[model samples]
Target: MRSTSRTEAFPAHTPAAAQIFTTVLSHGPLTRSEIAGRTRLSAAAVTKAVRPLIEAGYLVEDADDDARQPSLGRPANPVQVDGGRALFIGVKVTGDELIAVLTDLCCRIRVARHLPLTSRDPGAVLASITALVQELLTEADGFGVAVHGLGIAVSGDVDRAAGVVRYSPFLEWSDVPLAELASLATGLPVTVDNDVRALTVAEQWFGAGVGLSDFAVVTVGAGIGCGLVVHGHVVSGAHGVAGEIGHVAIDPAGPPCHCGNRGCVEAIAADSAIVGRIREVTGIEVADTAEAVDLAHAGNPGAREVYARAGDAIGRGIATVANLLGPERVIISGEGLAAYDLFAEQIREAFAAAAFGSAARCDLQTRPLPFEEWARGAAATAIQSFIRSDTY
Candidate 1:
């Protein structure tokens, strides 16, 4: 961590203040009336909350030249977040690598770095994270601002409230007090959460989920994970594991999952599952998912069949989510999208066949988000913690 003077705490802590600020963040440069209309707060309350924020440099009013867009019938002054007020660090820890980013208060990435991990041990991963965060802290120094908090997004069951990794199959970790350890190592506040949920927060604020209250983000990669936003709140479930679509069983006797279940969505559609199936069906020594995709693209019947089966399993899993939550849209993403061309039609067909009635109308949009976006999601969680005083 860089040696810098302590910065002051955020000025607004009230629920209303957080709501007002987030509203402006997603749709900023809004007049007080617009803020009040969106937040459902009284004009008086909006003024009260906006005062300290503007005075503390967290919010700024647009200048007359830019604010006066007469054609739009907008007011002369609109308040917006001053993104340069502070900085945050976000890290996404995978089994083989770590992705980190330094972001402004608005969750915009300023610097990003990647480091390969040699070990999955908690201590080893913490050291790697510390090294990456230290580099970003140095980058923040050039901007002459403080890095307020650090957010780490990890796979598996994460309890954000406790800041612990209760279980992570990819990392083979359980009961790791990650937040305390990272905070101790880097001397910054820490927030740890499930990787997909962290990503959902970013989407809700600035990505595809910005204006929608009901949507799902399903990630297909080394693992299959889903993040859900229902009625404008990210569902964490009662035990920090809400959207485990990967574990949802579709076939009773297909293959065994690491979670001790047979025929789970993960067992059928995860990258490892696809590669393993391709090797079994073709008797080919395909080493990785990339090779499996290549074989399928090369017109290998067995490899193509494996991808089709995986796509069917994934489609069914998504249908289950739609059946239960009835979301307006489902965003499909992750590295596994590399072979999307091979199975795109299969997924749509299977989903159309399985989804019930109105659920079939749900939009299924595919988005290819890089690992850096996942790290940005982690930063969004850090910003959420800072604004809500959830951790600090």
Candidate 2:
């Protein structure tokens, strides 16, 4: 286990300090006035919050001749977060693989590694995670900065406050105290969250969801997942589980879900679901989702029909989200996008058909994010926990 004896607390603990830091990290190199304007804090407050950060080497000011405002009697030099101030580790666990990355404080991936998982057992997965983190920690030694925190992204009902994996269908796990175990093993403060929500945090601060007050991230792969951002905040719901559109039942007569439900979106659209349906319909003895896609791409009518149905289910599920929350955009992503051509039209058509009047106007964007990006998203959560003073 690594040592936490050298762990340092954030320079400032006030809400404004965290807010200011996040603003710079997201849309940075801004002057004090601009920070105040964007964060809705007074210039005095922004200055107060920025001082300790600058002194701590977390924020650095850069000369900007073009930003000089002589009329205001200020240079308007911009301040930005120092990406090298510290490092972090993020791990994204799938049923069969582990993706881990070493990241700077700005959530930029400095180094990454991928390991195949031979088992989905909690203990086995934890051991794999411990090994990967140790590898990343060794990489961090070259940077001469402490790895402040570690974040683990798992697919399931995760209680961030409790640091537990309440249920993970993909891994067949229940009530696993993943955060506590990971922290104990790696000797770094750990933040455990739903994979989709973790990815949403990264997007909200750095990726597609940036500058948007409301957006949704819909991931299609081994399982379908959704992460929601409303009014600039990622919604975790009162129970710590929200935006589970995959379980939204769209057809009562449809296939059964592992969640013990019928006609759920996941049952119809998840990678495993699609593969199984393709096998049933085409009797091609396909081994996995890749083969299923190949069959569809090769113009197998049965395989194409299966993808069409899955796309419809996914579309209807997205429509459900739009009808309920009315987000500005829906980002569709994940490893499954490799076969997006098979059913892209069906998804759009079904969404357009089911979505309410104005809700149908929501933009649907496709982003093909590899597992490494998902690992980076996990790192973003660690950055978030560090900034909020939740992981010391």
Candidate 3:
């Protein structure tokens, strides 16, 4: 538990201050001028905002080392976030397990804990999450910093503003008020967001999407999910459902989806979909994605074809995203990348065939993000909420 007597608040309250601080947090050790440039704020505004943060110990200016001085004798003192100033907790809930991480103000993971879930009942999951939070909170006590906030990442349709898990197919959940329940149980301000969007936040701050204003994160595994960042903002559409690439129906005659749609991307490309397809095609008793991948690697033509078809479906989904958003880059990640060798060519080929002329130019890069990184993304959202003063 956090010490009740230790009262602390972020110094800068204005939006400009939050923006400046976030710039420094993400791209710092940046000079004041660089912060101003990146944030497009006036130098005076940047200085004004940075002053309070620096004074409050959230931002730190580097020492005036002569070696860092420019040739013109101007001191280029870089400013950066003091990560140790505060702490946060992040929890990522999957159908089978709970992943939690203790992170600092700068969103660096300090400790990670994994707990297998015996049941997917909302109450059971919430209890597990509460217990995990308490454990991490006790761990934070050793760091001597206040755990300011907590963020929970859930899959499917999550209403972040309302702090609700609208639906999670894997967990068979609907309209679960997770954030409110977790906050009440754990005594910490909570931010609830879709798992992929939370990961996008981390990407914007520290991963492949850094320095790119327009990009998409396409994750392939249990479900085909996408997170879109347009004009430097992660889009959460008016209806609390945005970038749902998994439901894009590419083949009407294909498999039926749990969302009651036929031939949706997830129905064809997700892990279970691939596993089932391999079983049907090869008559092999593959238990999971690993066995399916192994069959393809062992020169099973039918299994390899199944992966190829899944890749084609995923590529078409990526093309749809590119056609609509024209993102500068599309980052492919998730556990499914373990079988990337089997599907890489098919994905590229299908994407090229499906993408429009200019959209085809979009860079497609593969990045392997582990479950721990997804948990870190949840922490990033907590840090985001804390700095922006949207505590809950």
Best candidate, lDDT: 1
Error of 2 at 13 (Å): 1.0
Judged by whole-model lDDT over C-alpha atoms, candidate 1 comes out at 0.92
**Among all candidates shown, the one with the greatest TM-score:** 2
How well does candidate 3 score on lDDT at residue 149?
87
Reference-based lDDT, each prediction:
0.92, 0.91, 0.90
Point out the higher-scoring one by lDDT: 1 or 2.
1
TM-score against truth, every candidate:
0.96, 0.97, 0.96
Badly placed stretches (over 4 Å) of model 3 are 1-6, 67-76
lDDT (10s digit) by residue, model 2, range 172-265? 9999999999888888989999999999999999999988999999999889999999998999898888999999999999999998989999
Query: What 10-residue stretch in candidate 3 is worst by lDDT?
Result: 66-75
Residue-wise lDDT of candidate 3 within 233-352, one digit each (tens)? 999899778999899999999899999999999999899999998999888899999999999999999999989999999999999999999999999999899999999999999999
